[model samples]
Target: MPLVEINFDGLVGPSHNYAGLSLGNLASASHGGDPSYPRAAALQGLGKMRHNLNLGLAQGFFAPLPRPNGAFLDALGLSGVEPAGEAERRLRAAAWSASAMWTANAATVSPAPDTADGRCHLTAANLVTMPHRSQEWPDTVRQLRLAFADTAHFAVHDAVPACFGDEGAANHMRMAAHHAAPGLEIFVYGRHTKDTGGGAFPARQHEQASRAVARLHGLNPAQALFVEQSAEAIAAGAFHNDVVAVANERVLFTHELAFADPEGTYAAIRAAQPEAEIVVVPASAVSLADAIASYLFNGQVLTLPGGAMGLVIPLEAWEHPRVRAYLDGLLASNGPIRKVLPVDVRQSMANGGGPACLRLRVVADPAAIDPRFLLDEARIALLESVVAAHWPEQIDPTDIGSAALARSVQAARAAVLEAAGLTELA
Candidate 1:
């Protein structure tokens, strides 16, 4: 039962739109009220999954959660009724948000090797920072339970209490000799209090929440590190740690301003894992603004089959002169990252998510996972065909409450469930 890392990406939902629901996400705010192409978004996501699969990696996917969530509307006392005002209409729009497609925020995972009971532990993220995301955990937990049903090898827990907001793996990083080995898990929190420096936005990941998650996972206190995300980074729109840094095996790719104390962070990591290779993109070469704009650190730094590290970034990063220059130098220097694979996720990038935000990384024995959730060429074709035939080509913010659009969105998701033989989720 050899363990390997499996990337479980969330299938971009048919209701994917730019409602501008996320507060700290600059891109989402900027793109609010714009027309969205759901069909193109879903297809682009599938293309990314196919890209990773072609790289000889084990890939899995989570079906989109039911949207225009009637239950959520009911909770808000807006079910089956027309909105009374602009505020109510905004509430209704929140119900249709497809932000759940960013599965990196779906859960916080501690691989078997890092936990006390020798089982992979996953806790659904509370995501209490925003109204739309707060509705995600319960549905996310239901999906997790189904996919990791083998209790012998996996433990899926409900989200930590909403009192302390937790944003999941987007704020977490793990470094080890290899995926299956015992790893040093680092949790990056925004602040200890609600009144903190993110300028105009809130610091989503609370320090208390990060500690609570570590405790729930039964991680050895010595092996766990809790660090604060730089206030400057947060104010500059590095809303999540993944926005500034990413880790894979022995390598950590990050920006110079990613943490409150870069040298201290590096020293701690080296002390915990002596082989840690810290690759910092100096601020002089790529400023915080450029890094955030390009989402340069929001890429998937993974180990290729040949045992060399490769980074999967978005086309936006490749196109940025500074980011491109930095990447070119990274490869020419014969550093830990040997390759930079650029992907087209403009649909997601436009809404403040990039390549890393689209997936969740889990380390486990593949045999323990539900096979239907795993992807193959046939399953990829099934998904592509379904999206092509059913997903909406475009959705305008003005069309959010239209009955015809709602029906189409609902039917499209149902079609995907049926095509993937996952009606049990429905």
Candidate 2:
């Protein structure tokens, strides 16, 4: 009852709240001559910006939300943060400790003030899993704790080392057993024990996903749903925050993103609670129109909406006309819209996330929320890809033929190496 809204985009790592500025897990941040930190100071990247907007959506149902400081330019207070491990615990004993983390699939970065190639990125290891992965994302954990502390358990994929229930089949059992929430529950959707070990996705990824679900059992949730997110084929392409079936009002459907099983999602939700309202988020983040565009350029992507249904598209369709036009407008204007430009098309196509990925709605006190109201999702896309041909993200001019973007697939890959490590963990 305390959590009323969910944002897929807003679930990145936590150094700050959804309504707050993007922060990094200094422990996992890219060092070795990487300027991702300073760059993050000047310009909040599209992915990270979208994360802020997604968190803002929670304000509609939650009352008296404070306005976030748009400019966290000098806010690298991460001097004390640490990656999850023995050292991180040592640092947390005194004061702050990152509760949990979001594995980042898309990275939201910013350029250092007045610098072109120099940039900084604020991220978590929620979606990405590699060598540089984090055991927890301090920023995301903060938001989840503030918003979902009352829930039985928060959702996460268990594709990493040292994850909750991964020690055994009882791994799920082990995680659930350790959980403190009276009714905590996590939904493991993929091949936990499915392929035993060698499925299309690495065996570890499946085990980790299942362990995350298993970790939720201790809360003894009323029920948890599981589905096969990936088919026997491709790894990406099925993320969307389209329809969330509450106990069963109508089925909260998002206008921005969609899923392969929209109706099924609604059906499953209705089966649980017939009285829940099925509110439709037709205007949140990116719309069906944007989906159409991304479908063209970007092939497919993934999404996480807390426990709600999330949406995803591919980066291939980012070149669509409507997407570019709309995004260009966001960058051109100077207003609140610019602040959330990351949520629009800019981050949508560049990173694995879309507008729905950014932001979370905090419900510190249960009494403050309305329980059934939908939030506004007004955001314009930014097209930073126009100069994709230049360095920083240097693309070949011959390949671009005058239409250059800041990053190409290869460039983005190199730019966010730390993020890549996060994926390896998964």
Candidate 3:
């Protein structure tokens, strides 16, 4: 039988934050950049830049993941992995202890005091890489994973495999499925099985990607499928390497100038499966065929304003109503997003990420997908069962308004601590 229903609640990371983080990576990685330009954001400082704070959503979004500065003081193999202590260790340090870059902004930014009235404070960990992982969006990737676990399963090896070079093919593919509009299995054509470039795992290495996708079954996005390499896709230029497809077999080629014309790919797909809902759209302004006919080989070669990529919008775009709608619709429909980043990053100086890129579409059974996907999650369910067994008469978080959500979060934090086997925190 075809893959259908999934039990997202079955999967949980150390933190409730991770659930949302992983799912966000799903959608964020699937997103494509503004077509007017081809390439995406630039890498930050050339060296191990000093640390800086990254500010993001207070409640609905993920906080940040900082790195440990010096060596460790491990006792009893139980390092600083506990929830409460982890939070303290991550958020305790002063602002600029080490050289760090804001993966979201792709520029030199500093942490600012968030003066929100009633919101749960998020923690950031001290994350580090030798010589620093170039341009790879480590922070954004982690935060997105945290967002994924918020609603979907958060498995580091299963959801985001550590084997596929440094790019994390498993996470990228799971993310592809998570963001795909409903009713369609989003496919990224020209996917690489292995990371050829020092950073990116182009859709070309199909072998590694195929195994990665195969293992992601039974999670929140049990239905999302991914495939590696296509004969037609190989003919396209280097940039035109990826293709995004939906569950109904609808296909969309990402950019204009890549390899062969996506118009041809669409034609082939249509001929192969007449019923397949395939569309050859471009991230740029022109049609795929027209773009090829005009540039790559003949016609008039024109250069757009921003590099192959276009102008980056502002970060506030996340708060925009239309942007919200696009995100909501993409989640409900299962559309896929394709961008050019080592990981799933929307590091624009302006709006930060592209459409449907910032939000995490962590799906469970449609029947179970509540406005706040966290209500019936298995971990919470277990916590509820425990609370009921110990003390029947208890308070519910919904009874409070935004003002008291912070307290509710604290209670929830205590419950999480209990679940994670740390008594001091509880």
Measured against the true structure, the TM-scores of the candidates, in listed sequence, are: 0.98, 0.36, 0.33
RMSD of 3: 17.8
Name the candidate that leads on TM-score.
1
List per-prediction Cα lDDT, in the order shown. 0.94, 0.27, 0.26
Runs in model 3 lying further than 4 Å from the true structure: 1-59, 68-163, 166-183, 189-207, 218-253, 257-347, 350-357, 365-426
Local lDDT at 270 for model 1? 98
Model 3: per-residue lDDT, tens digit, 1-426? 121221111111111111111111222223212121111121121000100001110112122222221122132222443325533332322110111222211111100111112111112211211122222244444433443333332222222232332222211222121222223232333434243233222332233433343333222233333333333323332212222211211333233333234556445444443444432333344333332222211100111222121111223323344433433443455433221112222332121122122222232223322223232234334544443333213222122112243344345335544663433323
The sequence of per-residue lDDT tens digits that candidate 2 reaches over residues 108-193 is 11111111222111212343322122323333334323333333233222233344222111011111111111111222233432
Error of 3 at 202 (Å): 7.4
Evaluated at residue 214, the lDDT of candidate 2 is 34
How many clashing residue pairs, candidate 2?
97
Shift in Å, residue 399, candidate 3 = 44
| TM-score of candidate 1 versus the correct structure, residues matched by position | 0.98
Candidate with top lDDT is 1
What lDDT is obtained when candidate 2 is compared to the true structure? Answer: 0.27
Per-candidate RMSD, Å: 1.1, 17.0, 17.8
lDDT of candidate 3 at residue 230, scale 0 to 100: 39
